[model samples]
Target: MASHRVMKIYTVSGCFPLIILLMSTMVIQSTQERTDSIFHYTYCAIHQNIQTDEEMGIADLLSSIAGDIQLRQLDLRSLFPAERFPIQIRFNLKNFDISSDAEYSIAIHEFGVIYEGSCALSGERIVVNDGNGSQRTSASLRPDDTGALFMNFIDIGISLTGQESIVGRSLVIHGNGQSDLEVKYNSTRLACCIIGESDGRSW
Candidate 1:
């Protein structure tokens, strides 16, 4: 019995270091996975009230159109110009009416104007201007049966690089998919929200 107990203790001791090393490796891997995982931002896009005459900011527009609709889970970081990193946008639409044939586009604005350039992902693309001073076209997006729009794996071309970062920009969903060159800009502004960090808060 004494010899058996000694052998058991020796075996346990011999394996202890290897077990600890494995555990430590697992912990490191978990941390790295979280760090590398794609992070996202959320926004609430609401329809603008036609009765209001006051020029309101994006925040005020959301407040005015409160209780009308809820657009959430927009990935802000994906807008950062990247070639290899494909961006995904997932959002739930609540109390909002969307036609099956109607088209829409997501526009980003910096310094109160649409950013001048374009980005392409996959075979689809979005442009701010067509270089001839014409309104740019937007990528077509469709909603699922659950009223959720999942724009997955969008590869923004080289437009969002260098001096421009999508941070502190305004994102607007327009009706009829009109760009900034619309004759009546405010008529097409469907829902608007300022890009912000993801902190489980609604904007």
Candidate 2:
């Protein structure tokens, strides 16, 4: 019994250094992951369409959450030299009164862009809805004739360096009254949100 105990002790002693080394490596890895996250920021924002019906009351808080877009930042310059880094767009918009069959356009505008004004002149259109152009027909996104939508897409070809991140930029969704079949003139701005940065996935 004594011999067995000594052998067991020797085995433990032999593994002591290796165990310590493994623990140290784990700590280093954890720290490096945190550092990497700090350098690569993520962002998200939420907004709702303008309520045209003055007779309508404010929506309940549960429904007022409206829609939100959580962007997963990426560096595509090295992976796809010809393409620009994309913004991952995910949102659940509700209470759309679409009927005219007009198209809606989504775009990212410079910081300080307001929802009441048209930004199509300088805004960068985001590709969404299965390779369709930024502008798409309302009927395509409406949910089962419910006039609501829950859409998600990854918009490519819009380059954004650290100096020009989505955070603080305005994301506008345009509605009816298009000019020349484009959002260039008299396009009704429906909704907008100023994106905000998040530390991790808690946004």
RMSD values, in order shown? 11.9, 10.3
Q: Which candidate should be chosen as best, given lDDT against the real structure?
A: 2
Rate residue 28 of model 2 by lDDT: 75
Residue-wise C-alpha lDDT for candidate 2, range 1-203, written one tens digit per residue: 11111222245678888876876687777776655453334454545433322356432111122466556556555555554456555566665554446555556666535443333333554433424355432223343356566766755533334544556676666654543323432345556666666654543
Clash pairs, candidate 2, are none
- Candidate 2 — worst ten consecutive residues by lDDT sum? 1-10
How many clashing residue pairs appear in each of the predictions shown? Answer: 0, 0
In candidate 2, stretches whose alpha carbon ends up further than 4 angstroms from where it belongs are: 1-44, 48-65, 75-84, 113-144, 178-187, 200-203
Query: How far in Å is the alpha carbon of 31 misplaced in model 1?
Result: 2.5
Per-residue lDDT tens digits for candidate 1, residues 1-203, read: 11111222245678888876876687777765554443444343433423232475322221121221222222344565433332344444442334344455556544322211111111222355433456554544455554455344343431222343344455555556343323233345555544444533342
How well does candidate 2 score on lDDT at residue 51? 32
lDDT for model 1 comes to 0.40
